[model samples]
Target: MQRRRLLPLLLAAALPLLGGPVAHAQAGRPIKLVVPYPPGGPLDAIARILAEKVQPTLGTVIVENRPGAGGNLGADAVAKAAPDGHSIVMGAVATHAINPWLYAKLPYDPVRDFAPITLVARVPNVLVLNVETADKLQIRSVADLVSYARKNPGRLNYGSGGNGSAGHLAGEMFKAQAKVSLVHIPYAGAAPAQLGLLGGQVDLNFDNLAAAAANIRAGKLKALAVTTAQRSAAMPELPTLAESGLPGLVVDTWFGLFAPARTPAESVQQLNAAFTAALNAPDVRERLAKFLAEPAPTSPAQFGDFVKAELAKYEKVVKASGVKLD
Candidate 1:
């Protein structure tokens, strides 16, 4: 009888350890980091770099690409995933902030469907012209472009990645603020858009600094102004659109990490800590600087608030521009 009583006591002691917060935290498959865009892009590059850095703290981190519908496919997959903290999406301003307003039907709700982890980085979009075109037109700055556009309306044309892309919106904002008409030509992606600019198929392009940095250094493209509220640290010598003449023309693209809503708060906290640490690492900072991207890590709560504000801001811009996608 004493032996039976001891066996029951041991069973009771082990039951609590099997099914609890600690157990849940310790038991899981390798975490997967999803990049909505194709591999080799800025988002993919950042995700891979972070995955390598965070593996020691978070276990195996896998970066997967599921590009389609301008990042909705991969984002939707993560939103519908089990809330076990094994999956996350490398979301951007396009997916979370602008897509809601631009698309008529979205598979996932940016705020309700996911938990914000941390804001990874912010990339400024630079207004650049083909070096040959800039010299031919004698356009040295934003002021010069505005003057020429005003003088020869509809003569200058600009290209963007797509209809609802940040580049497109930036071009529209420039037109609205500068009071000049520059024909907009939408291309498949930034690469093709940059090619269009290079081949003289388009007069100019509002491209992400990362995409244009190499070309600018190669003397293929001339940057006029950065589309940010302040000058970018990657290129501190470059002026911002606000300082260039348009005081309120700021268009920055940001990337962040997100988990499905209802994920355990403990897991969320762990992820936030890991990613924030990776982003602040000296080597990571150095890598991101090559693309002119600034590392901006924020708390989960802070990132949530920032997303809300961006959604609201983009809503107004999209509506005013009357740009929508199915």
Candidate 2:
């Protein structure tokens, strides 16, 4: 009887040592990193880049593309995935921040459904105009574009990746802050929008810096101004929108990693540390910088805070601009 009682007491004392499956300290499971955008987009490229770096650190990192509904599909899939650090989504400005306000109903709540890991990088939008239109419209800078748009009203139009995309919102923000009447033209994707701009089918394009920088340098598209708070290192010659005239007009399209809402805090920490390490790598920083992206490696808490602030900021932008997508 005493032995039985002592055995029970010993097991209770050893419970802490056992510590719930030993945390699996070395999980060989492959981590699925989902990208919400179509292949070859900025978010996709960023996700692929990080996956390449992170694979060595974390077992096998597989990238899965599930593009649709402005990135809501993949986000919803990740939100409902097993919260075992084995599945995560490469969430972007559209899926994590803007979609919350732009869509009438999102499949998942950006804040409630996600456990933010770290912000990988932030890519600023570049204001690009067709060379022919640039010359005909006399568009030289952001202020010049604003002045022309105010004078021309609906005659001037800009192309974006899609409705409720960062490009669309950036153009609208520009119109609102500059007090202009430029019509917004939404494209099915960024590539189509770029092609339209190049063919002179569209007057201007608020394009991703990486996608437009090469064309701008080739003189196929004339860069007007960068839409960030500071000049892009990739194109140091360009001016910021706020620097041109409108103050506080900073809008950068950012991408981060997130797991399911109920992911263990320790698992979240491990993933965050891995991503932060990858982002801090010198080669990784250089590669991202070439695309005018500022490398940002944040703690999980910091990333979560950033997401909340971004959601609020874009919500206000959507409401003020009255932007909505079905």
Question: Which candidate has the top score in TM-score?
Answer: 1
> Per-residue alpha-carbon lDDT of model 2 for 67-153, expressed as tens digits?
888789999999999998888998888788898898898889999999999998888888889999989878888778878888878
TM-score of each: 0.90, 0.88
lDDT scores of the candidates, listed in order: 0.89, 0.84
- Give me the overall lDDT of model 2: 0.84
The alpha-carbon RMSD values of the candidates against the true structure, listed in the order shown, are 3.5, 3.9
Q: Which has the greatest lDDT?
A: 1
The pairs that clash in candidate 1 are none
RMSD of 2: 3.9
